[model samples]
Target: MFSPRACEGDTNPVLIPFLLAAAAAAAAPPAAMRLDYFHTGDAREERFALDAVVREGPWPGPPDRRLDDTGLGRYQFEVRDAKSGEPLYSRGFASIYGEWETTPEARDRARGFQESVRFPEPEALVTVTIKKRDARGVFQPAWSVTVDPAGPAVDRRPPPAIKVWAVMKNGEPADKVDLLLLGDGYTVAEMDKWHRDAKRLADTLFAVSPFREHRARFNVWAADTPSEESGVSRPSDGVYRRTALGTTYDAFGSERY
Candidate 1:
């Protein structure tokens, strides 16, 4: 649902986790929030140049009894290869507000509100649509988002995607090869961030025993996907442990969380 350049701004504060006591004074109009794509754990501070987008909007301002009514909201996001103009992941949803309050002076307030949330990564876009519901139960489009105008970095030599196969000795499958997948438990964008980690793991494996001796006869697997589902709960499913990090999920390469 993202077009292009719906709104724009500097690297201002887009999202402050919902605990600001001064939120009333911090509300504002929609602004383009910039974010970077990083490969997980390259270095605590070393981030790869990938494209990500963030937008802020649907904020309540000083009362306009005859005109405007909305509240402050923010989103912290990350996406990988998004700036490459490639389709990877995509979603679209709206944010709604309910539980509201009013001060002695008759100012409207909100307590435990709801908002429609949509994330579309496969579309090479991350979209947030916020709408407000009025007393008569009507929905109105509040704000929209799109980002990363700079595009993705150009690489003459893009690394190969991870692939796994049985090691072959004279074209015959061999055994005992170990595949290790590593990653960060933080965000979906981290999947791209872990690519380097995966390569590093492969190199390390090649430097070690049994693996080193049978370098051509051994293979390593790298599950290059983010662990975003690790913290989520799903019923009627088998419990899964994240081997790369200390998180758990009912996840696999082909299974939906």
Candidate 2:
């Protein structure tokens, strides 16, 4: 299991804990919940298995925006009230396996990828369903599982030794779009550089037209992992290095995907 970010290390950090505490005391919003699972198979077939359910932190997204009606991505997941079958939360997301299955490699061998879905923690039991696009692009149920919000199976452990800071703060997270900046290939010595890189990335993002115009509607957050290496693995160039977060280039034969 990967250690959580919002991880340890920074002291007296601003905003996050405040929101968590407020949500705990009042009916502000539900805490964020994450579902981790293994997606396995090849181009011809597929399978899913539950891995773990974790309490990440306070939910940052808008409570009212529960359903993703855009019908995007190759896959979609829905969380519903177990008894009434009322859809509580839903989202469409693209996965690494979604692309991996289309590759020629999938035709030769089977592969598995660890994937996760995050939703607001429900009050009681909720049935989660994952839908997949068919040949005609119609979304259909592929997997379903039931999760209890107060179940002992939920992992409530503290995060790892990491540092979190806000690059840009715009009101509360629920009222704004929250952007998370996570580094994979960076060592303890490169923390300052990572900080600079995060700011630069945020700047780059806001330099665009829409994001620049609506800057106040977004909150940018950054986390430092302090891996053993300074650069991610580039398997295409015959270079490999181990890091805390395993991110690499040459994915799906793309250099910078």
Give per-candidate clash totals.
22, 0
TM-score of 2: 0.85
Error of 1 at 101 (Å): 55
Residues 1-257 of candidate 2 have per-residue lDDT tens digits of: 33455356674356578878988788666789999999999999999999999998778788778999998999999999999999999999998899899899999999899999999999999999999999899999999999998999999997666678999998888898888999888888998898999999999999999899999999999988888877998998998978988888998777766
TM-scores, one per candidate: 0.23, 0.85
Q: What is the lDDT of every predicted structure here? A: 0.37, 0.90
Provide the global lDDT of candidate 2 against the true structure.
0.90
Whole-structure CA lDDT of model 1 = 0.37
Top candidate, metric lDDT: 2
RMSD of model 1 against the true structure? 24.0
How would you encode candidate 1's per-residue C-alpha lDDT over 140-228 as one tens digit per residue? 44333453333353222333454433222222222333444545453566555556666676777678887688886554555554554
The 10-residue segment of model 2 with minimum total lDDT is 1-10
